[model samples]
Target: MTSPRKVRRVVSLVPSLTEAVAVGAPGLLVGATDWCVHPAGLDVVRIGGTKNPDVAAIAALRPDLVIANEEENRAPDLAALRAAGLDVMVTEVRSLDQAFAELERVLLAGCGLTAPPRWLDDARAAWAAPPSAPYPPRTAVVPVWRRPWMVLGSDTFAGDLLARLGVRNVYADHPERYPRVPVAELRASGADLVVLPDEPYRFTADDGPEAFPGLPAALVDGRFLTWYGPSLAGAPAALRAALRRAGPVPSPRRP
Candidate 1:
């Protein structure tokens, strides 16, 4: 009988996946970026940032498998790695559902076996039914990056996640992907919540309530709220927790 091939020694180029594997399946993570948190003090070698990994440094790790995300990585780097004869698998997650599936796929492929995190079911349930009574639908704005000010457009994971939360998207009106808008426009939104993600851009209360004063501001964890993967299972609940912290959506109540 032929022996089974060993699939050990992994290099994770995706920030969310790197954190997931480090928590879901540790020890095997031979390389990750400085942004890869979770698992506390993971000594895995540093490659580079999520968008642009130091391919040479990663190659030195001699990883049998390299896990990266299509959304987080660039084409040129991937092409370069392919030309170098390195085995790299990329996962592109446009929605929350896709994120969960991809995380499971990566874990199974890299670790041979893995258990779905407990948060998965909880997130699903939370999304299906929030704690609030009659969970009134709300319009909201999800900003991923600033300066130019990128927002979560229709059909994206951020949009879907908000939909799951029983909130209607304000930018659903726009057709462009991650379109930029003026702050003055944001101040005039019909949205009840101005979701300020911790990443892509870090917005603080000091930034001024006038920026989003009329609407209640929600400070959410960008990783959980945006990154879909094994991490997704926990996100809905994290969102719920954030919502709870922010309290029930008030004002502009429907008649």
Candidate 2:
């Protein structure tokens, strides 16, 4: 385990982890995936997408550590990096608590930091309490993709985030983490709202809301909904505002 002091160079495959690492220690990152777009003017060697990183290019960088996610990066890619003698720190974040803990582990334990970053504390403070509601929590279907129609299902970080925000993911109890369901099934899933994010699919107000004719659709920032980094600090407020502005759902049409 290379200590944080010894970790002068890093290659990050995960976008969220990229932002987290870059924000925590600027200039420590020498390589990152093309999707690792945060901290705005980040200048690093692009290693391709999360699923298809150039292992040879990464190995050539001779990074002290490569940060990845269990769900984001393929095992074979991580193995190839390890085979090239690169140390890989893989993180698993399924829920809010796990996200915080895993982040601390990556920064403090993996990066060997003296203390957790201030943004981590800010994220914690931002989501300290569940949203106060006047009515029962709204039931929603959170779609990550459209063509195949996969949705956020069971024990996911995004689902947990929505739960904390007083929105219940209708498919949270489904067997799969991201289940592919037909558009008609999703529309008839008895959801009170359709939470559409702008990435992984880029669902806009005009693009996504039409599918669920009578249901309110909240077009949210994908970074807030999916990315678990410095953005976590503002995610709660941002998501809540989007939900509040969702407007009313029209009455369901009779068959």
Q: Which stretches of candidate 1 lie above 4 Å from their native place?
A: 1-5, 114-135, 229-231, 245-255
| Candidate closest to the true structure, highest lDDT | 2
> At residue 214, what lDDT does model 2 achieve?
70
Give me candidate 1's TM-score against the actual structure. 0.86
Candidate 2: 10-residue stretch with minimal lDDT: 129-138
Q: Model 2, clash count?
A: 0
TM-scores of the candidates are 0.86, 0.94
Provide the clashing-pair count of each candidate structure. Answer: 2, 0
Over the stretch 1-255, how does candidate 1's per-residue lDDT look in tens digits?
Answer: 434336678888777888777767667799998777755788989998887889899888888888888777888888877777788889978777687677777777655554565555554554556445224666678777777777887667777787777767789768886888887787677667777778768766665334776567777888777765455666667776666565557666578
Computed on alpha carbons, the lDDT of every model, listed in order, comes to 0.73, 0.89
